[model samples]
Target: MKLKKNITLGLFISASVTALAWQQSGKPESFAVNGNLSGFNDSIVYLTYGTFDDTKIDSAKVTDGKFTFKGRVEEPVQGMLFSRDYKLRLDLFVDKGAVEVRGATDNLKVAGSAIVNDYALFNQEIMANRKWVNNIFTEAWNAKQSGDTARARLLEADGNKWYAYEYEIRKNYIRQHPSSPISARELLMYVNNKTLDECRPMYEALDAKVKASLQGQELTRRMELLSKIKTGNKALSFAQTAVDGQTITLNTYKGKYVLLEFWASWCGPCRAENPNLRKQMDIFGSKGFNVLGVSLDKTRDPWIKAIEKDGLTWTQVSDLKGWNNEIAVAYGVKAVPANFLIDPSGTIIAQDLRGEALNQKLKEIFK
Candidate 1:
């Protein structure tokens, strides 16, 4: 799922983009949600992500365990109601509104009324969070203005506290919504900025949890591994089946310098790179250098056709698993036109080699 983030603490609300609302989209501005929520009027309902303001509550009256929200917006508006920690969930995507929430709160017992009448208000409330964060910095700024060194330091401490709080909140959101791409990215940003303490148990725990959850998610896992691979010195091993139906292991090329080439049948860039690779292969074939081409094609016909058309004379191997190929997973290859050049000792020497640079390297080593 594509995830988007529209708010940041460092930015003012006026700079924030308005969230898309279902009520404004001409779909349906009205919704009746019924479940088991008690207290208040059963007709009362709460709304969030409805307005330009930050407060989550819109408008509602409870009645017969049912509540309704009436507002309109443009297309692609999403809504949901959940009991703490998402124990009970009701989520919907509306191009227009007109949504019904019969089973949303069916089993929850909630007191008090909820309403999100103005989209602007909901946005404002969300901005209020940022304002709270800014207050920490504001205090520091005020201290500096007053020329109080001790107060400035204290306020700076407060600002760091706010950063930690925001980081933790984003972390918890990622934990609860393991599939939320936005939360995952925000957490990664914190990690990259070194704002999240690497030595903290919480940091390690969250990393382990996310990695475990994303284990089989090809794209996410590949992106993550690709990020690490650029900085790592370890050799990667993978197994795939050859067109002849023989299983091939990457380690089989252990004693030789290997060029792990990732490509596809439909990729013009890859096709363009093929001749250069073949030239290098020709030049280095008698040397220790070898080529192992892995195609990302899903079909055998195009894969084989491309090999012939491109004249890629090398040890071609693939499982015919296409994009889901296990070798691709093991190597963290997310895109075609990518590669890794490894030395005879099995340490990666370079990646994404192309054009004359590729030939230049081979010449240096083998000539």
Candidate 2:
């Protein structure tokens, strides 16, 4: 499965020029941002506002160690500011009002908005915890390279512990601050990691306003889609272009036990699992077992190379859109090396089977 990536926190500040008409609860008619960066002089800073699916982006040039952006937003929305090189990023909750961003480029301090402050506080804790986790992983890697298996395992365990601790902190924050916009954002993080049964209570506990926000709406959509793909539900039907430039659909393999696999060329764990998966396919291929590989690769070359190198003879398909791959999104696949094992009649019998578990499951099913 794909590990979580670093989150970019983009921020912006502006001076009010003219008021634009918009209304949000307890917010102003117009919003202004004033940003001061210590080391970023005469550089361009870009600002983007809204959710992942819908966003408005604008850029301003830094002059005299500061930059400004003024606009009107209907409600408080997620906003990001990043430098041209993308080395600096600040994320905040943006609404119509006088918002101020100041401090070192790497450690921005946001003020003048309650939601923004709430997000900042929450983001700080997450970033700190993530840094610690990264350090642990780094040490683990070093230990592995030096052939210190015991130290590496200990460090890996520590990393996982910290990761779970961070998740709990986020969960608790959401539970404690149901009204804060950050709570909705935090809850969205668990969409892929937690099941519907585990997440429904937290989602229902959110404030009505928070639930109606953009991130909340996205979470709701994910939940609705996930509900249809539970263990007992039939696998979602989808069509994608195969590596040979032909169209393929899930129904094409209806008569066999199919493992609908989501993977990517760049995913290390996916590459590592390919050999084992290939072995399983060999033992079961003649017995009506098949694999439908759906790649999340953004480009064609590496995908082709990986397949050849791994000896993956199964049917492969992709739209070459990376994480936004059409089939991947349809299946609600948040990570690579994820799969659903479907029976001959197209019912999902099992999911996320790997290595010996996969081998054992197939033996039990066909024996």
Candidate 3:
């Protein structure tokens, strides 16, 4: 009886810590965001965040560029602040508290919460340190787009150190500040597409309370899921409603080398890769390769239109639920344009092989 009581108490404390991590909140009933955007007047602004269909959390009318919002959050999560016209966009890290904002669209800032400040500071430092790498990457991208592959490769080689240093810097910060929600947040982001072994050290290094936070719980879930998605692991079988209202099943594609693609209609990059993807499909269609598209589109019209416009001839499926699509959540697909290459035996052999990488992999397999 005593052992069971201890276990229950432990669970209770974990839940309590997650709910009350926002200090100075006194476990407040709700959070308030007060803003002063002196550069504009009589406008509408929005505060939006959440993974599962709660994107638009709150909104307020700005009178003379001043507005106020009152809401509650169970844990720390990033929110988006933007005008109704969508011109001004800024990242706001928020939890329960009185968060204050001041300045114009170009210079807006959030204050009155340590976690929020840390989030801003982390961005500033990362940008400042990564400026050189960013320049090189931008130049490389331009070179590649202009068909200057040689120069693009050269620029990419030059930026390799900065790329590695960025990872090192991130790992250092996460280890040094285990208590910060920013640490937990970045750690979770960094773990994307990584193996369980790669993420376990830092995941274990996080503060106990931080690990018990909502994001922490998500991280745990991701790592657990990661084990089953690694190379040599069997592809997870799934069934979903296709765009044409028919049921689609992964088991039907078991005998072919399949590209299980996750994308969305609103993703510009996903659309940009359509022509190249179509070319690959044409070349490899008879060589035991096929493509399956999984869309994260919320509406039917845009989803269907994008398929027709992009000339995507593959079987596409979606639940018309946007980010709330259960398959996306299952795969931890925070962003789109991701894919997994499954072999004939239903084993996931590779992933995210875009552009030239995808071509090279297919060539090696089909050669």
Worst 10 residues of 3 by lDDT: 1-10
Worst-scoring 10-residue span by lDDT in model 1: 110-119
lDDT string for model 3 (1-367, tens) is 0111111212211222232244422242577888988777547888885432234467799888888988776666677788767777777777667788888776677786667666655554455446667777888888899999998898899778666766766666676677766667677767766545777888887778777766667777777777777777888888899977899888879789999899988999999888888999999998999998999998999999999999999999999888777777776677889888999999999988889999999999999
Record all residue pairs in model 3 with backbone atoms less than 3 Å apart, i.e. clashing.
none
lDDT string for model 2 (41-156, tens) is 64688899866567889988888779899887757777888887777888787876778999888788888666666666666767777787888898889989999999899889
Best-matching candidate per lDDT: 2
Instruction: Summarize candidate 1's per-residue lDDT along 132-220 as a digit string, tens digits.
Output: 66776777787788888888797788668765665555454444433322223334434421232341333333333333322213224
Clashes of each: 51, 15, 0
C-alpha lDDT of candidate 3 relative to the true structure: 0.76
- Give candidate 1 regions above 4 Å deviation: 1-183, 186-224
Per-prediction TM-score to the true structure, in the order listed: 0.46, 0.78, 0.76
RMSD of model 3, in Å?
10.7
TM-score of 1: 0.46
